[model samples]
Target: MAFLGVALLGLLAGAAVMYVLYRPRFEELRRQAEAEAQRLRESAQAQSRELLVQAQAEALRVRNEAEADIKQARQALLKQEERIQQLEERLARSQEKVDRKLDDLERRERGISQRERQIERLHREAEELKHSQQAELERIAGLTTDEAREIVLKRVEATARDDAARLMRQIEQEAKDEAEKRAKKIISIAIQRLASEYVAELTVTTVPLPSEELKGRIIGREGRNIRAFEQITGVDIIVDDTPEAVTLSCHDPVRREVARLALTKLLKDGRIHPARIEEVVEKTRQEIETIMREEGERVVYEAGVQGLHPDLIRILGRLKYRTSYGQNVLQHSLECALLAGAMASELGANVQVAKTAALLHDIGKAVDHEVQGPHALIGADIARRLGRSPAIVHAIAAHHFEEEPQTVEAFIVAAADAMSGGRPGARRETLDLYIKRLEALETVATSFPGVQRAFAIQAGREVRVMVQPDAVDDLGSITLARNISRKIEESLQYPGQIRVTVIRETRAVDYAR
Candidate 1:
């Protein structure tokens, strides 16, 4: 038993030694673990504090940006509000101007109404005064107002009639003066522009003999040759007293021309027998016909006329043998055509129509003996039958006043005819005939009631009549001149135109005291 006790006590001592060594080491390890946990907790708290501070700073920056944005928006709204206020002010001023214009219009309307009432009142007063004055005048004059008005109107009408008549006379005088001046200028220019030779052709043909003795041979042994010659040629062979000249006289110019040619040939050949005479005369007639045609064509060409009928040309050729008032009809016709054409150019008329009409104006004289009408009318008919235009035909007919000249061409033709016939030395008149024409002109002029003396001047182209001033007034003198002109036209058959002039003289004589 004693050995077991000692062994247990030794085991207990070893256990106590092990407990003291392990307890201090265990306390130290637990303190180290607690301190490491506290350090980890402090690190986590500091990190969280820094995160919170950063978040607050970020929130402050965001709020400042929002405030700045709100300030800009407010500034824009304020500027817009100012603009609206200005617009309102402008609208208010415009309304004020409109109100002023309306007020002015209303005032003008009121003033116009007042003026209209005043005018009505004044008009009534004026009408009353006029009626009172008219009544007083009627009472003083012892005549009705209508009677006074009629008297005044009659006087005024009489004065107006006198004034109208004077004005009409003055206008007539001025117009006549202007027309006369223009006519004179046109005629003078036309005459000055054209210079045509005036040849006075005789109807009678004269033949020159080599000797006076040849005349007896032409008479041919006891008048038998003469009679045969006359019978064959249809012309009178006059053995006149003239030296070395034999006269062939015939109304038919063609026959006269033929006789002239035959006589010439007979004298030249010295063969005066009847058979030779008939043969020579027949040959001469043929030659003359040929000459007539050639002459017709020559004139037509010279005058620049075309498209004439063959028959018409031949008839125109016959005019070469015809004479009018001692003027060759063909020459006169040519002159008329040239003058008419010149005048037509100057006056802006159809030159061809004028020339053609004027050239054919005397064509009727060719066959007047055969026809039963005036030469103008006959010529017109011939031209119409030849397919001439109406203007041409009318011009031909009216050249001699047979028909009233309708166109300017007709008047031109008439004027050309006058110019051709009226030129100096163009025609010859017997002294007896000329004297008779002058006397007839004077007689016609003096036949008027108030004519003191009448004088035929300008070779019967003009008549000057002197009128008594007391008997024929200025107006009366005009009437007398016209009447005298009409009488002369009716009585006289002279060539060209005649002018009538009437003169009235008013004399005032006074002696100085």
Candidate 2:
């Protein structure tokens, strides 16, 4: 026990000594740890304070932005409310205006109803008054209403007939005098103003060769060159015993012209092969087309006609090569246009319409060989299809009397056509025969009964017969026309056909003075 006590004392003494020896060091370590902990706590406190400051700054910024947004929202709400209020006010005003309109309409409707009622009552009174007056007249006249009406009607009819006949005779005399003077003056003026020369064109064009040996070369090994030339040019090549000349025969003047040019070029170039022929022909075709276009442009400019379609101008150029009765068709058209313009200016008509119609009057002849119709109608259709005015189309259609000339311009165009085609040396028609035929037509028409006067117009194609109204009634006029036509058919051996037209006219005139 004593040893154990001694050991325990020693161990306790040793533990005490060790504790005393490490106490300062342990205190220094504890102080260092505490200082570090204090430093860490201070840093944590500083960090927390910084974080709190940043959070507060962010909160302030967010709050300011939110407040600004809320302010904008509030302003928008206020503006919207103000707009709504204004709209309400406008709607209220509109409602008031509509209400006033409704009231006005109601008043007008009531007034209209009253007026209708009053009108109905007035109509009834008027009917009664009319009936009473009619009865009183019948009683006083010692005749029924029917008998009085018939007598009055007969008297009026007789008086009107006498007045109408006198007026007709007077008006007809004045019209004839004025019309004859105007017609003679206009015709003379138009014919004097426009002078055109006639150019005769043959269907066949002769190409002169340099020598006979060249002809053999042109024949080109079994006539291949000639065959190629014919096929390309759409023209018939006539190589006969005509001295050193080859004839080009074609119905189409344009084709004939092209063939002539191509042959001339080939003869000049002295290259008589199929390939050379094709090249020469193509080059010649282009040259001819250019010439046609230039001619068309020149003629159109000369005629002072503008706004022609490209295709129309091209076709017009084609007319340069076409000939009608020894007259260049394009030249004839130009002359017609000038004459028509002069007449139209004198008569105060549409000069442009007249000139354009006259210019296009023979346009159908350009394509007449292709289209199957009268040239007048075909030309009219072409003009109409190409956006021409109705007056121009009508003038073209009426130029040949295919349709009746209705407008003054149409008549002017027809007159221009007649003047152009009937002038001396204009066509191949014998003037003596034309006059004789016209005289025969007039004689045949005037031989009919009740015929007061007979006039032959439209190149002896139509006879206008005027009948005495007293001698020939409407039905009698028809019969007279038929008889005259039959007599003309039986007596005269005319070409084509003759149109016999009978006219019976009535006129009523009154002098306000």
Off by over 4 Å in 2: 1-178, 195-204, 429-513
- Per-candidate TM vs. native? 0.65, 0.52
Backbone clashes in candidate 1 total: 0
**Candidate 2 clashes between residue pairs 3 or more apart in a chain or in different chains:** none
Q: How close is each model in CA RMSD to the real structure?
A: 19.8, 16.0
Off by over 4 Å in 1: 1-169, 181-193, 240-244, 486-496, 506-513
Compose the digit string of candidate 1's lDDT tens values, residues 334-356: 88888888888878999999999
- Candidate 2 matches the true fold with a TM-score of 0.52
What local distance difference test score does each model get?
A: 0.89, 0.86
**Best TM-score among the predictions, by candidate number:** 1
lDDT of 2 by residue, 266-314 (tens): 8888888989889888988899899889988888898888888877778
lDDT of 1: 0.89
**Candidate 1: which pairs clash?**
none
> For candidate 2, which ten residues in a row score worst on lDDT?
195-204
